[model samples]
Target: MKLSSEQIKQKLKDAGLRVTPQRHAILEAVYTLGNHPSAEQVIDFIRVRYPGIATGTVYNVLDVMVESGLVKRVKTDKDAMRYDAIMNRHHHIYCAESDRIEDYFDEELDELLQAYFRKKKLQDFKIEDIILQIKGNFNDNSE
Candidate 1:
């Protein structure tokens, strides 16, 4: 979901966060790049147009955004943390070799997992979210 600067500001305001130029640029960079990006990737993107923005500033902005529910933090099996712009419920397909991530949404799979867990009925544990990371290599030439 691409958002204009004004819309991004409004989103931040709605989330009870102050809208700043750095935050706006960071959010815009994440939105523009649909693929899950690491902190360094975000910094590189922001630096192209926002040369003055510091790497630390980008990381801080991302942390605030994730905490405020404006973005999501995806953790791969390899322990690498990636930032996702889309807040909606979804899974990911992670490419091990390239460290690329792609969104995946499957209603049936979600329902199956929910039903299985409900039947199992683990005590004292609550499932907040389920994000499956299917690890593999992305075939670029094959559809």
Candidate 2:
């Protein structure tokens, strides 16, 4: 999802983050990558267009984005931390063999899980959200 400068600014504002030229460029880099990218990947992407951007700034922006619900942190099976740009209610379909992650959306699944959890009603622990990472091998022929 390629985000325009105005869209990026709005997103930053919505997240209550102070927008700066550097932050705008970094966020644009994340959207340009599209696929879930790690901090190093984000830095690499930004450096091509912005050679002067500090590596620490990329990491800091991502941390703030995650905290402010602008982006999400996805941890792979190998414990590699990746950044996801999608914010809607959805899950991830992960391919362990390929280390690939795809967004999964199932309204029925969501309803069922909610019903089950509501029935259980575990004490003292409130459910903020539920994100399931279904792991399997991606069928190469599906394409």
Candidate 3:
């Protein structure tokens, strides 16, 4: 999902964020990387293009973008916070060995979860989001 610079500007504008070069570079780095990356990784990427950008600026930009619903922050089992560019509904598969995260989606699983929760009928509790982190080892030979 490669977004053009114009599209990135539109996204920032829509989120009520000032579209600056640093913000654009940070967003592009996250989107292009696809995989959930930590703030440090984002900073490293931005440094290549915008040499003067500070690490703290990247962190601030990510926080603002997430607060504005432009990006999502994912917490892995190991307790590392990773930022995701995709904001849609989906689950994740975390590889224990490599500490890698992969997106997972299934209509059947979604429906099952919804139905199960509806039947349970917890009192006064609302489910804001459902993100399943299936921990497993990577099967390199299978592929």
> Per-candidate RMSD vs. true structure?
2.3, 2.0, 2.1
lDDT of each: 0.86, 0.88, 0.87
* Top TM-score hit: 2
Per residue, candidate 3 scores C-alpha lDDT tens digits across 66-108 of 9999999988766657999888788998886677889888878
At residue 117, candidate 3 shows an lDDT of 92
What TM-score does each of the candidates earn? Answer: 0.89, 0.92, 0.91
Give the per-residue lDDT digits (tens) of candidate 1, residues 80-120: 57889898788998887777788998989999999999899
Clashing pairs in 1: none
The parts of candidate 3 lying over 4 Å away from their true place are 141-143
State how far residue 112 of model 1 sits from its true place (Å): 2.0
Error of 1 at 131 (Å): 1.1
* Model 2 per-residue lDDT tens digits across residues 6-33: 9999999988999998889878877888
Task: Please say which candidate is ahead in lDDT: 1 or 3.
Answer: 3
**Would you list the clashing residue pairs of candidate 2?**
none
Candidate 1 to truth, TM: 0.89
> Backbone collision count in every prediction?
0, 0, 0
